[model samples]
Target chain A: MRVSAPVRATVQRLTLPFLIFMSALLAVLGKADVLLFDRVRVVLADVLAPVLQVAGEPIASVSRAVGTVENVITVYHQNQELKLENQRLLQWQEVARRLQSENEELRNLVKFAPQGAVSSVAAQVIADSGGAFLHNILVNVGSREGVARGQPAMTGDGLVGRVIEVGGRTARILLLTDINSHIPVAIEGTHDHAMLNGDNSDEPRLVYVQPKTPVKSGDRIVTSGSGGMFPPDLPVGVVASVGGVIRVETYADLARLEMVRIVNYGLDGILPDGWVPTPQAGRRSHARAASSP
Target chain B: MPYSRNRDYVGFVARMVPGTTTFLFTLLSLLPFPVPSFGSIAPSFALMAVFHWTVYRPDLLPPGAVFVAGLLLDLLNGTPYVGLSALALLLVRTAVLNQRRIFSHRPFSVLWLGFFGATAGAFALEWAFVSLMQVEFLAPRPFVFQTLITAACFPIGSYVLALAHRAMPALSA
Candidate 1:
């Protein structure tokens, strides 16, 4: 096992380049036709699935316990808090009722309401890339569960991220806070469109906004859904001034993210003139037709 | 003859373990855990691990392995290219290797300073490359905080790595 000095030096010299070459090869191969690598990535993820499940279980238990404790604490203030919250919710409920009726009336008037349907599944976070330079999470869902690449994922709070790589029983989510993540968003107050760009830092930057547009701190941001990648009007975060830069303080707390819902909204066929199957209609089609002939 | 052979086997295992540990440490650092709205910066756990091993067990952990670890990190994290981290890690290893004599005799304060200096260099390199790529305003504060957090984790990581070194009879030689 005692290596000669020359052998040791040679080994040292070769190591870095070899690793670099392998990494480059992996990156290049990963980019070739998402479908090809998508399958491979899935298989690899499946192999890693058990690891994620084991890692995630303890975190999930802790989070659930924390949630239970918070619920119990809130119960002490429940009466007073609920009174105030109930007043606010009642106002919202009235508005919601009106909106529901109005939306129904509008849909009937339009005659041809786009009959798009959506299906959803739940997934657990297995592992997280928690560093200053990357923001991705491995989830325990894959192509087996009909989870596809580009599917939008969210927490109960708001937009968490989207699935970028799906494996057989696992998928990697590119968090909205990742440096490489960019989503089209709009300001709730001003209706100004901008791109929410993740810079490997927590607070995402609001880019592509007009200089003259009035955007202020505390302004809410939501997905504009212009690309049809995500549903429209999903709450993103509030605009907060960090130093002088306006940044979104996302609603979903990533630190405590344990479970997430993977929305099955088909973005591909939802756009004009596409033929993607809608979940609800597809499900109903299997049942007896109401009226024939 | 058997005793000498056993010693060689122990030394080989000692040398190899650090490489595997370096890889595992890099993977742990790259785990996608999101920090609060400090911006996208998470703590540099891998950097801390590398710094610890290089400071205490240079024979076990080599410069080339450090570079590879950095490249692996870049790939796993889905960064722009390989050289960004490789270059930073190379610089850190070079600095650590060169100053090993001064650090070996000095107290913990000097070792801490060396770590700070190395981290500063690595952070500056990362920030500069990221900025050059036209992503300046994402969240500089988080990175700053992350650097501070990483620096804080150093002494503990160094202590643990030191313990690991002591546990292995071969590395002590």
Candidate 2:
């Protein structure tokens, strides 16, 4: 059947306005994380993640090649830097040895019971968050590999993010540079606790510190583990700039995140004994737990 | 345009090629390759596709596919608001769909310029939506860079899309 001109034009006019309304509703629902939409998103991600994994294969090797090229270009300067770093490391090694023995003896005398062994699953970065609004990465490991919500994901350098959504074969990590990311952290020298809040910029600000807190540039920051989301004393980063506005340079380079480890330090308070009857409830509880100071 | 009853299977598949190719290109952009700071500023290939197909062949790359493409991107990249990209694309589609006459007849440079303006508008909408959703003003530098880079990459997307569009008739039947 042939369509009439006026009717077709009316429908065409209605299309844009209708789509605009639906798009707004979707944005609201998605940001609010309405149950139905989030479930579909998670399921879709799980289904589509393998395509990402396959697409990511070339990325790893290409990055590795680029790394080798850079290494070769800077080998001489790197050697000189390493020579000086080696001497400093040697001095620190002796101090660490003494501290370790003393701590072990003190622990033995006090009969300290060490917790269970920390286990971690290694995963490849399959995809990067392409937009400016969110800084996230998709890893190949997921709930099937025992990864769960609120688990701290790290690289060899330091913390990369925390697992927010986990499917059977994939998980989404919320990077510390994301606007929504707020991590509880402590300055090394001052030992003052603060929050590492991401503002969608490279350097996340350190907030919630007392005015008298003696924080300085180059002072290290580590996970405070106050909220039970992460274990105590995980090295996060060093204070890149401290005066005026405190900023931390994360150890893990968000730009070149290749491999990640979802650490299972048995610190996940949301899912007690790996019991998640429903994913939405588990995620909600984790959010509630995360909000408490 | 609605899928007419007279349209053949081959015609339907041919119509879908542009959207599918754009979806794949968008997927390609998500890989974290070791480029110097390019990962954060990688161009929006999907936007380029939407803009291109909107100007040339809205019947093939319709609003519904554009919306789905945006949502697919959201799910893939794990954005906070899933429909922000969709809204941006829909707005871009609307913006271009009305002015397709001038764009369709303009020279290549003018087309590129048009893409730049549309991308700027779309990204502004996305950035505003995100800041409103989070209740804070997000830094504009990233989106600004993304818009520039995407416009610069427009020629490449257009070139490839032209090839796909040109090559479809041969494969359709």
Candidate 3:
């Protein structure tokens, strides 16, 4: 059926405004916590997710290949470096062993010891939203894998970031390098607390530190877990100076992130009251204690 | 006589091919890929698709369709408001439509220059509107890079669309 010229013109004129109106309505409804729209978004995401998975496969494969090559090169250099560092570490290890025995004896004598717990799960980084404005990664693990929002994500080296959004099969992690990402951290040497804030830059700035706090470059920073949003004592980063601004050089190298450990260091609310274990549990406890301390 | 019927058939095929191809290309642009060093950013694949269609087949790629495609992108990327992208796309479509006479037969360099101009205008408008809404800055750098990459890929996209146009014998003028 051929449409009249006037009718065709009318259809063309109405189309743009109609779409504009519908889009605005959808946005408003979404903001209003319309359960229906949220569910729709989720459903659409589910439908499109497989396409994303397929498109991402080639990129992931390339990254893995590159990572393997880089790892081999680094390992060769590290092996030689570790040979020398190992000798010096042996002396430190002896001193540490003596100090550990002395401290244990003192704790046993005093009949007082604090114990904490730790548990973790391995996850693959599937997607990275690479930019200073919003540093986030999509992990394969999701709520189905017991990955809850606000759970602390880490790399082998130290704290990576926290999970902010979770789907049934995927979760979005807000990395420590994002401009809006901030965490309460404490300097290892001076025991001073400061807020690590990302400013769309590689190194996140340490803010709110007292002027008298003896925070120096190279000092280790760990999550203080003041608000309980994250587990305490997770190694966050080391203090670095860039443009005279103190920033945390995070332990997880954002440039080469591959696999990550999503810590299930179960929330304190889930723990049994005043119950503690020996040795193994004690070690876990010590790790937790050291995390905050 | 029979030539009128043939022309109608050709127009029908031309319209069908461009719409379907643009839709699929737009979908491809939204796929999430992990960046080794940086986090995730959805590049504007739909923008490139729309731009190509507008430049070569404006009759098939209309402003209304461009607006809808932008809305889909905003939805998939989780942007605050959908109309912002739609508005930007409409502006790009209108600009291209107005200058189609000059650009329709231009060399590749001129076409690319036109693309850069259109993309920059769209990006600036998008950034301004998004910033005004107080939503978190999604970083324009990635989008800028994506536009450049899309511009680079235009020849390929154009060629593919052209092949499709040619394959459908009914679409050939």
Over A60-162, each residue of candidate 3 has an lDDT whose tens digit, in order, gives 7887798799888899788989999999999999999999999999999999857566667787765555322346666667777887766788888888877
Q: Per-residue lDDT for B80 in model 3?
A: 32
Ranking by TM-score: 2, 1, 3
lDDT tens per residue, model 2, A1-293: 77999999998778778888888888877644445555676787788788877877777778778789999999999999999999999999999999999999999999999988899999988878877766888888888999988899999989987887888888888889887677778777666777888877888998777577667888899988776778878889988997788999999888777789999987754435332223244345445444654
DockQ list for all candidates: 0.27, 0.50, 0.27
> Highest TM-score among the candidates is held by which one?
2
The CA lDDT of each predicted structure is 0.68, 0.81, 0.66
Candidate 3's TM-score reads 0.73
Tell me how far the alpha carbon of residue A203 in candidate 2 is from the true structure, in angstroms, after superposition: 0.3
lDDT of 2 by residue, B1-173 (tens): 34453357667778788889879887877877666555668789889888888888888887788888887887678775777888888889988998888887679998998999999998898888777766678899999998988899889989998998887887565
Residue-level lDDT tens digits of model 1 in A1-293:
89999999898788655655554454334333334434444565577568546644655677678779988888868888889999999999999999999998998898856747888889876666655565777787888899877788888889988777766888778888776677778889677777787655567887767577867888899987666667778888998874566688899986657679998877752223221112232223222111110
Clash-forming residue pairs, model 2: none
TM-score of each: 0.73, 0.87, 0.73
**Which sections of candidate 3 miss by over 4 Å?**
A1-8, A21-41, A66-117, A130-133, A242-245, A268-293, B1-43, B59-68, B78-86, B135-173
**lDDT for each residue of candidate 3 in B1-173, tens digit (9 for 90 to 100):** 79999898777876788777877776665444444443433445566677777877787777667776766655444343445666767777778877888777778788878887887787776656544443456457755764566567667766777787676665556
